[model samples]
Target: MSSKVIHAIYTDDDLLMQAVKQTREANYHIEEVYTPFPVHGLDKAMGLAPTRLAITSFLYGLVGLSVAISMMNFIMIQDWPQDIGGKPSFSFLENLPAFVPIMFELTVFFAAHLMVITFYMRSKLWPFKQAENPDVRTTDDHFLMEVSVGKHNVKDMSKFLSDTGALEVNLINK
Candidate 1:
C-alpha cells in the first residue's frame, strides 16, 4: 500500500504539543516534524531517538588527528630532517608541541566535515531531492507535523487536527 501523508500546521507550541499527544493516543504514526527553530522538549515529545552524530564526529576527529600526527612525524623526522637555528628534529616526542597546531586543525576539520556529511546523509538531504514540505509557511513561521495515514482515516485525522488547533492541514498522496 502506498503511504499517504497528512501535514498539520500549527502556530502555538502548546497546541502543537497537545496535537502530538493526541496523535500518539490515537496510535497515529508520525513521519516527521519541521519547525522554523528548535523547540524545547519537542524531540522527546515526538519520541524521536537521540542523534549519534556527536560520537561519530568524535571518532572521525580522532582518526584525523592520528593521521595528521603520523604524517607530520614521518615527514619532519624520518623523511627529511631540516635544522633551523640548530634545533634538533627527530620523532614526534622530540617536537610534540610543534605539531599541536596541525593536529588541532585536522581534528576540527574532520569533525566538521564528517559530521555535516553524516547529518546530511542521515537526513536524506542530498542534491536534487524535491522539498517534502506541503506548505512554505511551515519553513518560516509555523511548525509542521507530517503523519502517514490510511485513505480511510484521512477525514478523521483532518478533523482531529482541525479540532486540535491546526492552522491548516493537507493530505498528500504518495
Candidate 2:
C-alpha cells in the first residue's frame, strides 16, 4: 500500500527544533528526523519516550562486577593463594585491594561492549542492512523532518512547514 509522507528540509538545527515543537503543538505526527549532527533535546521536543538503555547498561555492569569478583576470589584466594611481596592472599576481603583494578576494568569493559551490542540490536542495525535515509543532503549540512500526511491537506501542511522556516518541502509517496 502507498501512503504520503512530507519531508520538510531545514538549513539550521535551531529552525528544525522550533519546527518540531510547533509541529507537535499542532498535533502532526512526526515520523522521523534526520540531522547532520546530534541536536540537544531533540528527542524530548519530539515527545519521544525515554529510552531504557541506561538500565540495561547498569545491569550489564553488575553482571561484570560479579564475574570479576568470583573470578578473582577463585584465582587469588582459593586456587593459587599467592604470597607475592609478603602481601598474603589468605582472605578475599583482606586482599580486595589487589582485585579492585581487575573488577573496575572488567565492569567498564562489559558495560561498554554489551551496550554497543544492545544498541545495535535494538535499532535493528547490522552489516548488510539496507539504509532508509530519505535525503542525501541530510547527511551533510541539512536537517530533514519526516511527517506523516494522514487525512490532512497537503498544501496546507506544506505551507505551514514552509512558514516554519523550511528551505524546501517535498511530498514523498511510499
The TM-score measured for candidate 2 stands at: 0.93
Provide TM-scores for the models.
Answer: 0.88, 0.93
How do the residues 97-128 of candidate 1 rate in per-residue lDDT, one tens digit apiece? 88899999999998999899999999899999
What does each candidate score in C-alpha RMSD?
Answer: 2.0, 1.4
Off by over 4 Å in 2: none
* lDDT per residue as tens, model 2, 18-52: 99999999989999999999999999999999999
Question: Candidate 1 at 15: error in angstroms?
Answer: 2.0
lDDT, residue 12, candidate 1: 74
Report lDDT (Cα) of residue 78, candidate 2.
Answer: 90
**What is candidate 2's local distance difference test score?**
0.95
